[model samples]
Target: MPVLDLTDLPAACPPGTAWLGLDLGEKTIGVAASDTSRMIASPLTLIRKTKFTDDAQALFRLMDERKVSALIVGLPLNMDGSEGPRAQSCRAFARNLDRIRPVNVAFQDERLSTSAVERFLIEDLDLNRKRRAGVIDRTAAAWILQGALDRLRP
Candidate 1:
């Protein structure tokens, strides 16, 4: 399967199918999932980085358990909106994942996603640095997924 645009995602999957959101960092992969109705996105879990096979297996396991029908991955675009190494890595990861599972994949613009999540955790939630670090990845994944879900709203 190819990486799809947000507008195309609903067409790719059946209604009431769950969607998995991923924020792939160097050391961890943050996971989030939407309700079967595609209305709410919530932080799920974090996968500590390991070998590619292990990471993929872990992601696949989550998808299977969650009954995920599509994947929405955060793409870390440069400030100028140019594709940088991180963005390329995200695209590569999506392509590789597709090769393994052949599921619908989509990318959401993730500029400042992490920073926004950290700020929210600190200011609104009043979380300390250590606590923030532990949850920031999955929170950012939810933020990213929420953005895409909002776009899908009728």
Candidate 2:
């Protein structure tokens, strides 16, 4: 499998298969997954970053258990819509992930994803700062995945 555009992701997956969403941060990897119907995304878990091999193994274990068939990774683009070092890092991670599992991976623009999620946690959920910090990464991953799912709408 290869890194694909968001629009091309569906073709890479078999019907009824789920898609895993990843928000790769410096210290932790946020994980989310779409329903089998691909209708909704939910925050799953966060993987504390370690070695690449360990991280990959952790991610793969989750994917396998969830029956995920593809990936939608958050691409941290600059506000100017330009790819920066973070975007490059995401691409490299995607490439490495593909090499390990041969899974189709797509990048979704993730500008303001974390901020949006933080706002939701504060305003809507009314979570305390400490609580928010605990789950922000996974929530942001869900937001990123939701954006991709919205684009897939007919």
Q: lDDT: which candidate is best? A: 1
Candidate 2 wrong stretches, greater than 4 Å: none
lDDT of 2 by residue, 78-150 (tens): 9899999999999999888778778788999999999999999999999999999889999899999999999
- Candidates in order: C-alpha RMSD to true structure: 0.7, 0.7
Candidate 1 achieves a global lDDT of: 0.94
Query: What C-alpha lDDT values do all the predictions have?
Result: 0.94, 0.92
Local lDDT at 83 for model 1: 97
Candidate 2 positional error at 47, Å: 0.3
In order of appearance, the predictions have TM-scores of 0.98, 0.98
Looking at model 1, residue 135 earns an lDDT score of: 97
Pairs in steric clash, model 2: none
